[model samples]
Target chain A: MTHQQIRGVYSAATTPLNADNTPDLGLFTGHCQRLLKEGCHGVALLGTTGEANSFSSAERRQILEAALKSGLSGDQLMPGTGVAAIPETIELTRHALSVGVSRVVMLPPFYYKGVSDDGLFAAYAQIIETIADDRLRVVLYHIPQVSGVPLTLPLIGRLIKAFPHTVVGIKDSAGDFANMQALVTAFPGFSVLAGADPLLLPLIKAGGAGCITATSNLVADSLRIVYDHANDQARAADVEAAQVRINAYRSLSNSYVQIPTIKAMVGLKTGIASWARPRPPLMALSAAEHADLATKFAQLP
Target chain B: MTHQQIRGVYSAATTPLNADNTPDLGLFTGHCQRLLKEGCHGVALLGTTGEANSFSSAERRQILEAALKSGLSGDQLMPGTGVAAIPETIELTRHALSVGVSRVVMLPPFYYKGVSDDGLFAAYAQIIETIADDRLRVVLYHIPQVSGVPLTLPLIGRLIKAFPHTVVGIKDSAGDFANMQALVTAFPGFSVLAGADPLLLPLIKAGGAGCITATSNLVADSLRIVYDHANDQARAADVEAAQVRINAYRSLSNSYVQIPTIKAMVGLKTGIASWARPRPPLMALSAAEHADLATKFAQLP
Candidate 1:
């Protein structure tokens, strides 16, 4: 498969669900429009950042349909459809492909750890064979620390070899620069998208395609500018410095609060004052946290 | 609210599925009969050890129904029905209660970690309110290292105080002896079961009711003997030695292969090699591991 359109900063936008906790189609549509307007190269809907697995199959289909209807083209959209079960993941991926999403990021069947690479390969093989979509662009999502399922080089090599056309890239959210660089270097033709915003410049310089980061939720435009001017040394250093401060805060709060903190920043900047309503099971920041975030974000350049 | 029945060895058995991956109802029936014959107090089905989360809701219902049909009474079974989503978990749990399985082990909504106890309370509250089953006896399953979600004492105190009648007990699988002792000491009346097989003696000596252990899959009879013969110092030491051998093997294998490894041991003892087949994403061990286990088993008391 040719590495043609998989480059630059791709924003994994949050799915704005309605008050009923269903996909807020209107808000999602508006968010996509705003993301594109704010200068993201493309958008990845229903990712961890987008909380894709939180929605059921029907809700997922509905969200995708609304995205297409709202002028979000497939060429610019990569939706997360990974599930614990292969059938469900395939069903979701097939739907995405049918709707013209050439690139689909996938999470490994993550419930089990220390799982054999063969099992993961079998899963991918089953999915690829079942879908049989020629335009299928599989980007393996590697967030081991969260999923407890790590996508190693041997597994990646196997998938890419078997479905060379289908498996074109990986999203290294391991948050380890060494792993990110290894991915870029190991898979020459494959697009290795950095999952952290801070590593964007280093990864790009190390032959990475670009980044699909969480903090991109609040800083899409700034990240896009960084991606565009990465070759310019002075500007690149400044971008890294800003990201260092941001990541320092992320480390303090625990990266699990990335979405909420980003949303808090978004509300602060836009004056919308949204409550940073993380779904139940993932608690929303307390009042003190909200106030602290606002004050801290105010100090960011 | 009085703790009556939860004081003995409970084996969280694996559901032996057929080649088609459907529940092997016949195998399970036989398995249950054997466990009862061997003198286990009760059996916990669809637990993390049983890959409960991997099975669909329909599968869980079917398995529970089969167990009921096979003469396992409500008092003799504890089904694990917790998932990431509250509504689905509630639905499945309510079904278990209705079908006469009053004792249900509930895992915390574990996918999202670093969540506040308030969120956990809301989740449990929703389940209790929706089910409204007077017979409901909830045993909170605490295995934070795997689930990425921890159940702190404050949350436990709040739940027990608020729903004294419903929140009957907890299975402290944190594997930390101090934490388990704290739970046993703090909730004097509440049934605190040891989650670790190795800690069974210590926990029992410290006011714990019994153990809900994964290793009970292979050594239920021995565990039962030890529990019944707790006063015999030499016998308890023998049982502890056997448990250490099993647990050491478990730790050496990283605990990821605990289910399959135990099943392999069962297969070796019963001459039912089909029992070794673990579900996809969890492959069966190779010949080398089988040989190693055989050598280790010979050294066991």
Candidate 2:
């Protein structure tokens, strides 16, 4: 992987919220430490699974500060600093860079629908220029299904051409393997992290960076096993079979909401009831649903 | 209209950004004042047209404060208090209420896609409970095309049933006339503000409160004419004809991005170049496009 700064398995970790919906800083910091110990290369904090957009800019900055104060190293963190606002995005990105976190995954401004590629490019350009930090490394986030904004190949190429050093990698969360493969083929030597867990092995084998996925939150050690041995022919079948099982687990719970289901799984695994509660607009799994998921999760190979 | 707190044509005003992309408070206040003078009943600051989500929480609060200081009455202002975060939304809503702005338009938590109605209800419920303000009057914003979240009638009914006084109105920007009509029919006496200019006449005829439209930013006086006479059988044809012209203008410039084109029109009309520049992720219209729009705008009936 050419973009080694952001290679290997990363978890788009879940954000634990208090009863009043405030970020649980202590729990979040602990989760980061746990993710690192569970075999994740780094934790992609505030990514979709973390409910990044659901927190205010102040809260996000405070969470970052708390995480750092609690002994989480910048090298092991890549916070999702993207926002609908350019200045706010710059503020978060600058804060991340100023604190020694070099790489940040950013979503394009997503509030406006049917925005042009030029608009999207101008947004990234402004953030880059405004931050004006040479050390700033951006891993573009592409999850059009949710954001309603796609970072097409042409746009990605243009961004890279304009700022080759600053624009380092991309997390293709489109969940289309073909799109991920095309991104890998188009930007050879560029870090192409898969957003979906099932594609982790294929993406690693395709000369790409590892995955930054939500599933890695709970199964980082498992994902790292596949990532580490993706090139080993002897482990190829086993990795594929394990991926299928992981995919099955993902599919079963994903039939419900992803963030809440993942939270429920975390609660079930850790026996932390509060972990099952997602912020509003994302309901916690029902007792029955959690029981069913527990049975299915236990049944997974 | 039954909901007098938010009746009549309102401009979903454009947020004026300074050269550095900061909210130009003076410019915004001037625009609001001008809208009022031009026959707008009120100004809906920070709606989709106003690029509400594209600014940080602090910036949004500052803009609202400036608008108030500039002598815009809270009675005639409905600032959008919606954000992806529940606490932030509650904070903004509480600020609006505390400052005497009883009516505020709110968007559902839009970051999570395919969220259940229960989840959406939870979000509003939490906000209402947390805010705990009897004076707070919320006008739900349903711009599914942009927000990627719809406030279906059932959900709206649920919110109203839960908090009838707080959840007072809806701005249906789904761009679906049928949806707006359904909302109006389903919730008799509930305020239904048309989010599109073209639907203003029909919506008003169908018992909608009025339109809170982007076009009202520029053509408030004209829209007021249609809204004021929507039920007059003798003037029905005239109102429909005016709506057709408004729709034409919207359609023409919307062919080349709505917000930027409107901003360009404002610049052309006022000779303020900065008015045309949208915050990043929203590129300004090229000189050529501006010229074309100017010609089209002039030719409008």
TM-score of every prediction relative to native: 0.87, 0.96
Query: Candidate 1 — which residues are off by over 4 angstroms?
Result: A1-5, A17-23, A53-62, A98-102, A129-132, A232-256, A298-300, B1-5, B130-132, B232-256, B294-301
How much is B184 displaced in model 1, in angstroms?
Answer: 0.9
> Candidate 1's C-alpha lDDT?
0.77
Instruction: Go through the candidates in order and give each one's C-alpha lDDT.
Output: 0.77, 0.86
Can you list each candidate's DockQ?
Answer: 0.36, 0.82
Candidate 1 per-residue lDDT over residues B1-301, each given as its tens digit: 3453467888888877687666788888778778877767899888877877666667789989998999989889999988766766788898997888888999877655577899888778877877888888899988886777789999999999988888978888878999988887788678888877777777777777888877776777767765666667768677666566546644543433777787776677677878877776767778898888767665654
lDDT of 2 at A203: 81
Kindly give the stretch of ten consecutive residues in candidate 1 chain A with the minimal lDDT sum.
Answer: A247-256
**What's the distance in Å from true for residue B190, model 2?**
0.7
Which candidate number has the best lDDT? 2
